[model samples]
Target: MLESLLDGIFNGISIGSVLLLAALGLAIVFGLMGVINMAHGELMMLGAYTTFVVQNGFKALGAPWSDFYIFFALIAAFIVTALVGLLLERGVVRYLYGRPLETLLATWGVSLILQQFIRSVSWQFAAGVGVFCLLFFGALWLISRRPDFEQIRGKAIAIMLPLSGAISLVVSNLLGQTYKFAVTLPWFGTQGVDVTAPKWLRGGLPLGGYQLPYTRVFIIALTILCLFAVFWFLNRTVWGLRIRAVTQNRSMSACLGIPTQKVDALTFAIGSGLAGVAGCAVSLLGSVSSNTGQSYIVDTFMVVVIGGVGKLVGSIVAAATIGIISYVVGSNALAPLVEFSPFLQGLLEFFATASMAKVFVFALIVIFLQFRPAGLFPQKGRTVDA
Candidate 1:
């Protein structure tokens, strides 16, 4: 029993790391700009596609650096997604500042457009080269209609919050109760599992009679490294200081000759970049797809909300707490009891699936907000005034 509990903890940490990465961008964007970015997950999807493209490109070049391709994909994904974020800020987001609900609808439309575009491209590619070319041109034409920078940066943060939250819920529900894996190996052929991965990346680390996968360890290390870097940036550098200033008081920072517009752009870029890195980490854990970002979106928002918007410590603590709790709840030891509880039993019947657990968790968070509107660790002093 104890052994199973420990295993669940390990699984939770791994899952939580991915959630932390996905939420970091959403948190910063929300805390600073106040936008509910509905398109954030699509941005992540774009990053994943970027990785897929890079992988294919490498294969075409006859390069077999699968291990190193992950790093390259991360970099490429960041650059592509950051540029898209910049474009989004300039084009659509700018006009909708202060009108959060409108921004939500608009970004939601954008997300659909992105998904459809991907679907079209995927299907068209399968059809032939000519159709792919037509679709590519059409996508370019559509993207050319974006707004200006001042407007985008102004509204970007404000529009990301609810957009991110709602989409997360939808995603959680869609992935309910099933774990699917598609494993491929150089040595062995493809196989299906509840969860899939490369052969070398599978298996576990020996500990007594138990074992833990190397992938889990990598996730923990990567998440820790990312969190450390984020903290270091927030605390140590001139740029970080400037970002803090803008986050706290945009007008005052503008008065101090801080190049507030540039700062906003850079901050958006960094946040989006972190999200791209998160997408890469996600790809390692599960099959890369358009909906992948949806899985972690709810938990990510929870981390930011519970941690206090824009608070790093809050995100970290909230992420770890949620991870551990969800893990314990999902484990065999507690599953039966949770399933038997009258209230939870109703919920189980309502959701009746493991995947919907994320939605339930998020629903609980919304309820929590009703009581503690300011969050678990609201920013203090002048730090939160912006």
Candidate 2:
């Protein structure tokens, strides 16, 4: 009985670790920045795909390297997603800072675009994106650095946008037939892919006469590392202080020459990158598809909301609470405790199934929210915009 209880608790914590990873980024971006970025899930999807690509690259190098691909994949996922997040912020989000509705609509569109792009990514498509980003970022750089270029910033973008498309068409026509990768008759990447864990993480770790899966143990350890990293980054670093200062008072931070815009951008990038790391961990559990991020996005959001907006500790507490409750109820671990009452046993049997467990958890969260609307830990001041 003790063994069963411990197993359930461990499983619950393992689940919560994933939630912590997913929600850590959301808490920073959504809770701190107040941007309704609907594309956050898509960013996680992109991270998973990035991992797939990295793993394949290692496999191409043969067997010895494939086992170590995860280290590289995690780094690549973080960098790729962070860059994408930076682009989203600069291109769409910056323009719609205070307009939550517009940001939501715009990011949702971006999410769809990203999903389709991955589903049918071609060499030609890759070439076109490269050309576009080159021209686009180059023009922006020139405008920022050169006084004369600033006058034609709008004109540069207007011309460069179409010019890049034209260049892509030319490149595709000339070199498309030779350069081929996922050149499918219809679709190659749509079926999704799975990432096998390394040999070291494949087995179980014996603890208290009960075995705990190494993957779950690794994930829990990873969560603790990430949590500490966040704390150290936010509290022990110079940039973290700047992020906090800018978040608290943008105008004051700007006046103090803190580069508020840059801080906001970096903060968003960090959050998105953390989401990407979450994707890497997720790949260990199941197949990664275009819809992978969508599976956990809702639960992640709930965790952040229940944890308290902009409160890291709250996110931690809330994730653990929700994870434990969901796992216990779903697995019927509490059955023994309620075995004395026949009516209660029947009720538990009905509602304690895996599918029905989430409904109960959601309902509990809603009821909790009714009593404490600000969440478990409320922000001290007016952090969110009206």
Clashes of each: 26, 0
Model 1 residue 284 lDDT? 68
* Candidate 1 lDDT tens digits, 41-138: 77777777777777666656653565456668878988988898887777787677678898889988888776665654422222333333344444
Per-residue lDDT tens digits of candidate 2, residues 264-324?
8999899899888888888888888888887887988898899988899999999998888
Residue 4 alpha-carbon offset, candidate 2, angstroms: 2.3
The global Cα lDDT (0 to 1) of model 1 is: 0.68
- Best-fitting candidate, measured by TM-score? 2
Best by the lDDT measure? 2
Error of 1 at 114 (Å): 1.5
Q: Where does the lowest 10-residue lDDT sum fall in candidate 2?
A: 179-188
